[model samples]
Target: MAPSPSSAAQHRHHSSLPTVSSAVSWLFLSLLFLYVVYYSTILFEPAPTFTTTTTTKTATDCQDISTIESNTTRVLRFDTELRHIAFGIAASSRLWRIRKEYLKLWWRRGETRGAVWLDKEVTTTENENLPDIHLSEDTSKFSYTNPNGDRSAIRISRVVSETLRLGMEDVRWFVMGDDDTIFIVENLVRILSKYDHNQFYYIGMTSESHFQNMLFSYGMAFGGGGFAISYPLAVELERMQDRCLQRYPGYYGSDDRMHACMAELNVPLTKEPGFHQNDVHGNLLGLLVAHPVTPLVSLHHLDVVDPIFPGMPRVQSIKHLLESAKYDSASIIQQSICYDKKREWSILVSYGFAIQIVRGILSPRELESPARTFLNWHKRLDYTAYAFNTRPVTRNPCQKPFVYYMSSTEYDKTREKIIGIYTLHRERYPYCKWKMESPEDIDTIVVLKKEDSSRWTKAPRKDCCRVLPATKNGTLYLWIGNCQTNEVIEL
Candidate 1:
């Protein structure tokens, strides 16, 4: 078979073809092994997956369903109103009767939504203008080691969480307060509307006392003045607060515990000055007369402080102040400064509250500073303890202000303005020795006002006022409204 030349060439070609085919088969098997080794891990191993979680168990049924449609749905946004807030007011059986009156002042029976968490049951009058009452769950399982603090702190701390568990509909904010807390609801609605309820917000002010804030934290919202938690934050708190509270057995109060939980959740407090803890004692006239530029939201410890209006009872004085609030809530206790150039007089009008006239012209800086008319919470005589700047009552008797508290404020429909009549307080002061025309002779001040909270959306500014010409011999007139572009408050 190898002797013939053509047959030999064909046999040689056949042998080379077999060798080439054998090499191709070996390359194909090697490639198959390499592909199996490299790709088997990828084909059989697990892949990463994404998930959306909330502190809710109700959505478990919907977990398998695609979330695209739900996620892509339009978010509804609306202005925060009275109905959107759930007020969790902490009270005890011992103080319920007296404190319920304070609640009645602000609560509209059918309009407001919330429950008063009490330690024990209290009888409710029919058709009472108060929030529904509920007995707080026993908190004896939690430890409170602070010697001076009350164990009631545990139950109070759970009020927000308990309120969240109520499963309220369309709840945007969970507001917490003591039973004695006086809330200016209209102002609360106005201020809360400025924030986005969808985000986590711990909105409140710290204690007015520096010592109190230093002892606990400036970050803690003094619960007396009240604090607001966005619904999202409340829900998160409801999920873990029982465990959080158990961890902090040594915490002194509900507020500090709340601060600790917020810290754990990596949220910081947002301070607002309108919430006044009113930790100080005595007359609040000076504080009210020279309010910060912000709206007055809450006033606490009303029973401890003297009546806001001289010679009026605690409840009546609040009602007197609310008279103006009923007409123009955003402007209550809001300060405006202007001058009588002819008389060289400095005049201050605390809208819906009082009017103060001093004999000498003073700068805005001195006027804006709160006068030390009230004592500190500790009853310390030293003025340096205050958290904010304060001015001493003028030693010079003639320069001291002649005060006039608001006697009445009514909406003048025809005038399209509020006419507030501030009658002279006539508190006998050190008689003025220097010769000058006396504002004491002026029996009344009529404040003409136009709504000015339009400026609240931007940087908040104090409303501006101009001293109008005297309308009656014994009456002075002033007008308060938004500031003019070129106008400035100066001497």
Candidate 2:
């Protein structure tokens, strides 16, 4: 079986040559295939990039998916330079759902789609389910009555523009509104669609007797509550920015300024059934969308706390608002702690501050006075009660009489100061507590500072009451004199 070594070596060498050649051929084919694929992909599939092109030549027609067509109607809401976070949350969650229900019924008219729910704020998880939100970033470009007024308003305006670009860029008709606005959405949308596209459509509850008539009367001018505008009107309104800024070379409230701008442009504002303004009876504007719209637009005085209209009982809904917050224990202290009283106070103070700043009594940098800062921060109480990074301003009248807290000695001094102030302005300053219609208006309020249940106790007054000396070690008390109700045990 033995053969020559040279013969065997030659046979092995020949076999190895074919194996190497086959490997080389496979490598060449793979390189050629990859080159072809890379070129093909370059020609067919493009990389992501930005462009200035609009939707004019496209079948979808609009650059943004958010715009409505001529036959469509939208319900929009605006926010100004203020913190109505609690109200916004409440409206978006509770009232919006109500409006959606009405739209479901009213949208049946010839493909007259549902109303557009819009707001001028950065949408969050709390309101992500809400239909359309425009996150605004250029609100600072807009002016407000006071310096801080822009904080809420600018954010809102930025959001509004964003919403428009997103929803109405190619849409024909749309409605603008505030969070607290109330109306019959379905009916309004159906009615608005039956209008002339050539004409401006500004639909809301019109006032016949100017601003004096019950807020929801008939007038031609569009209401800030919820106004529907055609595509032309939307475009025209959007274009009014230059003139609007020029006309008011200073601070301006968004809603009122918008009305003023409309007037200047001579746009014929129209109306539909169920459009409303600031009527709080909750009865005047029957089930649709309700607005907490206007005050959020500009600076609010941080003094007027409490609801204006008695239509809705002042229920403590902060619990609901708080429950809606995400459970991030770390950031709990960083959130706004909104209080019912403080919320009212913020409105009053902001209103006054807005006026002052507009009238040149204050500047933006100095706008954050002790009182102003306190009120601004007070709004956070709604969602962060009993939770804090630092201790809350604890010191008398922690809940009632609307007075600041100081030590017992300081309380007396402050009380005397208040009495003296009231005495001096008694003719002009009326007592707020006695404005109630009845003696039975008293309700018990149990206020808590910490999570301890034992710390909770009944507020001392059984009737409409005011603050008093505490009877317990760490509790406060109140005495409802008009209703002759009084009990005390806690400090």
Each candidate structure's TM-score, on Cα atoms with residue i matched to residue i, is 0.83, 0.33
- Per-residue lDDT, model 2, residue 215, is 32
Off by over 4 Å in 2: 1-128, 146-161, 167-170, 207-224, 249-252, 280-491
Model 1: per-residue lDDT, tens digit, 87-114? 9999989988788888888887766799
| Ten contiguous residues minimizing lDDT sum, candidate 1 | 58-67
**Per-residue C-alpha lDDT of model 2 across residues 25-96, encoded as one tens digit per residue:** 999999999999999999899778854322222211111112233333221221111111101111233344
Query: In lDDT terms, how accurate is model 1?
Result: 0.85
**What do the candidate models score in CA lDDT, each in turn?**
0.85, 0.31
> Which residue pairs in candidate 1 collide?
none
Q: Model 2: which ten-residue window has the lowest total lDDT?
A: 351-360
